[model samples]
Target: MKKFILDLIVKENEHINEDYFVLKLTSNDKLPHMLPGQFVEIKVENSPTTFLRRPISVNFYDKELNELWLLIQIVGNGTRKLSEVQVGDTLNLILPLGNTFSIPGDKNSRLLLVGGGVGFAPMLFLGAYLNDLGYRCDFLLGGRSEANMVQLNEFKRYGEVYTTTEDGSMGEKGYVTQHSLLQKKQFDMIYTCGPTPMMQAVASYAHKRNIACEVSLENMMACGFGTCLCCVTDTVDGNLCVCTEGPVFNITKLKWQI
Candidate 1:
């Protein structure tokens, strides 16, 4: 658990009347290399109710610039206060703190990445890596509306991008699972993150087709590590900490009730 005082070098509200924000942080100290599915625990400088540092995924990183980017959505007081931070502000952070997705092998591997809402953060980095390795990838993103689909443009370079919106305000009108690729294509592997129902849906789809699938789960985390025992889940392998054991897990091992 390496700690650092990172200066909020830039902050941008990516949407209107929405909670999504892109935060860029810089530190004089050399930070650890962050993996795609890993996250960071950030301490909101002066809030009491938001006492514990919030764990947020590492959206992207720039080694040359020595910076880290986080795609945050304000869903509560902690994140709401986090959004209020301005440039030059500083926050305590412990980053690169969780397990990551496994890169797929084979040139013809049909890789499918599915995300919803702010859960798209990890996929951006995952997509970039797959693209760098000469792998073929397809991204399916779903949101309530176009405004909820953040960074869809940024991911175009990494793969063939597809979108779905409940209101038909974007690429296609329906849930991402309803996208043609999910319904028609046979992927060698599928990686997903989002709401539980959505993840469960993707997992079920992959399971039916016998495709290898992994999901990065988003749960309410306290310690952002294994010690807290806050983010626990029952799996085929028994109970595991979502914070440390996962954030990433094989879909086949997930003991889903639904």
Candidate 2:
């Protein structure tokens, strides 16, 4: 896909919780075509301590409104600075970066999307894309607690929503992999993004069941292009840059034990 560096106006900076915020950005011109599972590198304008642009997943895009949503978690100085932007602020971004989740061929293929914490960002876009294509989607989301589970109703607009939280303050009292939906329903394909351990477990479960699976790795992608090499992951094809070759990869191509 073609990449573009554009200044987007922040229409809203909604604080979902103490840790998470959603930045709704808009451009005067029509936005470029972006696929599910793609990301954007934002230039932190005023944070002197931060030298690199922070990479964030595309949470959702509303073509009708010309808005792009970024679900951000304030983890460091860079993100902290970003979270402070006002409604009229201009955020520069190199967008539509990285590969996308593969769409299943069969419309009837059962699909499950698993996400944890802020990793739930991309799953929303992916689920919406699949839902628009007449494919059924089930979202299995996990977080530390109910506070961490943002945008539940928005996700439900695209598909069935299931959830898990470590504190038992939400839908289920365990990890997403432990959700009862997995046991009750059979999925033909599974897509996941989360902490490494969580995704590994989900991958393992899918592998054992002989289901097609893909994972979006949360690697450190300092540069949205391949030059950085910071987001490289060992795959069956060798070490590939996640920023360019992926952020998304099929389980068979990954070097994960599963």
Candidate 3:
């Protein structure tokens, strides 16, 4: 595992209600080559409750700026403290961990990218990566309210963006699955990350259509690397480490029940 002392070059609160912050870290050395689904373990220096680092998905990267972006929702003490990080401060990170989303092999591959709440992190990068691989992509975002949605512009560069909020204040009033189904279109593959139920719903829809789907699970984890074995999950294959074996897994390989 490569360790880096990076500068917290930029920090901003993107969404007010949810306390979602977009942090940019710049490394003095070459930034690790990261993939869509990989995450970084960050230590929120000097916190009582948050002793161990928290794992957050890599949201975006700009090679020219030598910067990496993170979409962090301030849930507890760790994130609350992370929100306070200012420009030029230092943060320790172990990055490029966990497996990443697979690249489509064909140019005409039609792809659907779905995300819910802060779970939208990886899917943003996934959409861009898939587009770079010559696949046509469409993004569907779901949130409790418009305030909970973030990084919307990032996905627009990849493909069409469709949104749904629990309340009627946003694009579509309902869930993301509803918006996706409304399109009434079939895709060659599906990729998603979000709350358990949201991902499950998308998986069900894909399965019923006999389309391939992959899910990036958001499990509570520590040692974001594989050594801790804290991110163990039961799958059709066997017990697997979400940190190592996957934060990304094919829906068919998961043991989800009806």
Candidate 4:
């Protein structure tokens, strides 16, 4: 698909917590189509320290509203600056970049969606899209505690939601990989995005059962167009740019230590 650069106005800037926010953007022109696993690179205006744009996954999009949702964690100077923008502020972005996750072709396929932190960003889009296609979409999300878990209610709108917080304050008490459902390998495919350790564990578990699995890598990206090679990861085929080639990779395609 072709990519486009546009300045989208912020329709809403909702703070989910001190560390995270959801920015809803609308374009003056019609919005370009973007898949669930793809991301956008936003120019960080007015922040001197933020020279490069930040890459954030597409949380969801509404065609009728001409709106796109970006679930952002304020982890650095760029995101912190982005968090301060007001409604009606225009954000310059180059987007609809990178590869997308595979959707099930079979209507009755069962799938497990796993996420952690802001990595939970893309699963909502993937799950809701899958659910609409008649696939069983189940979510397993992990955070440090109840205070850290954002958009639980939003996730539940798409599928059966299971949760795990490091503190025993939520649905399950450990990492998502420890959830009993994951151990059973009952799903047709597993899709995950999160901390490297968490994703590695999920991939390893699925690999052991010979189950299909895909992971979205949140590598530090400089140029979203893959010019910088800053986001390349070691794969069986050699180093590949996470920005252009993926933020999503099937387990078999990756050469994880698993």
Candidate 5:
């Protein structure tokens, strides 16, 4: 897919919590097609300490409104600057970067999406996409606390929403891998994005169950293109750039010990 550099107007900047915000952006031109698991690189203007653009996952896209949603976690100067932008501010972005999650051919395939922390960003878009195609999607999301879980209602609009929190402040008190939903039901495919450790656990569980699984890696990225080679990961095929080759890969291809 071709990439574009555009100044997207901030339709809204929603503060989900102290650590996270959702930026809804629109363009004078129609928004480019974006796929689940893809991301955007946003230029941080006026931030002297931040030189590189931050890579953010596509949270959700409202085609009817021509809006692109970005779920951002303010972890550094670049993101902090991004969070400060007001409604109607223009954010320059290179978007629809990286490979997307695979869509199962069988519409009847049962699917589960697992997400943790800020990694929950991409799952929403993936679920919505799958739902639109008549696939049933069940979501298992985790956070340190209830406060970390955002967009619960929005997720429910797509499928069954389940949650876990380390502090027991939400649906269940445990990691997503430990959620009882896994034991209660069997799925044909599983897709996950989150911390490496958490994803590894999910992959191991799926592997043992003979279920197909794919994980979206959150390796540190810069340039949002493959040129920087900063987000390369070892795979069965060889080292590959997460930016260009994938942010998403099947568990079987990954060199993870599981």
Candidate 6:
């Protein structure tokens, strides 16, 4: 897919909570084709301490609205600066970066989308698209607490949303891997993104059941494009750049011990 350095208008910047915020941007020009797992590198402004641009997943895209959503957590100086951005502000973004989620094309496809922490950002868009495709999709989100399990309502609108809170204060008392949703149903595919351990666990479960699985890697990225070489992950195919080659990779390609 072609790339663009678009200075998009910040249509809305709403803080979901003290820890998370969602930014909606609109492009004055035409946007390139953006897929569910792809991300964008936004040049951060007003933060003297941060020099590098931040890479965030494309949360959702509305073609008719010409709008793109980025679900972000205030994890560092760059993100904190972004949280302060207001409507009408222009954000320079190198976008439609990385590869996309592999949609199960079959109408009867039964899928499970798993996400941990801020990893949930990309899954909503993927699930929504899958729903549009008439596929049976379920979402499994895991966070440290109910507070971290931020947008269940939005997720529920797309498909069945199951959650796990580490503190036992939410949907399920254990991690996402322990959620009953997995045991209650058989899935054609499992797509996940999260902490290393969590993803590995999900992959192991998928492997044990011989289910096709793909994971969106959340490696630290500097450049949105592959030129940076900072987000390389060891794969069966060799060291691959997660930024460009993927933010998404099939579990068969990964060399995890699981």
Q: Write the per-residue lDDT of candidate 5 for residues 177-240, one digit (tens) a residue.
A: 9899988999999999999999999999999999999999978888888898989999999999
The better candidate by lDDT, 1 or 2, is: 2
Question: Which pairs clash (backbone N, Cα, C closer than 3 Å) in model 6?
Answer: none
Which residue pairs show collisions in model 4? none
TM-score: model 2 vs. ground truth:
0.98
Tens digit of per-residue lDDT, candidate 4, span 1-258: 788889999999999889989999998889999888999999999999998889999999888889999999998888999999999999999989999999878777789999998889999999877876677889999988886688989988888999999997988899998887776558888999999999999999889988789999989888988899999989989999999889899989898988
- Over 4 Å off in model 6, which ranges? none
Residues 1-258 of candidate 6: C-alpha lDDT, one tens digit per residue:
888888999999989899999999997776677889999999999899989999998888887788899999998999999999989999999988899878766888788999898888899889877877778789999999987887688899899888999999998899999999887899999999888899999999999999999999978877869887989999998999999889899999998998
Model 5 segments beyond 4 Å from truth? none
Report the alpha-carbon TM-score of model 6 versus the true structure.
0.97
Pick the winner on TM-score between candidates 3 and 6: 6
Runs of candidate 2 with Cα error greater than 4 angstroms are none
Clashes of 3: 0
- lDDT tens digits, residue span 141-224, model 1: 999998888887788979989899999999889888888776677789999988889889888888888889899987877888
Q: List model 2 lDDT by residue over 116-135, tens digit each.
A: 99999999999999989899
Answer with 4 or 5, whichever has the higher TM-score.
5
* Superposed model 1: Cα runs more than 4 Å off: 1-17
TM-score of each: 0.93, 0.98, 0.93, 0.97, 0.98, 0.97
| Deviation from truth (RMSD, Å), model 4 | 1.1
lDDT of each: 0.83, 0.93, 0.83, 0.90, 0.93, 0.89
Per-residue lDDT, model 4, residue 56, is 91
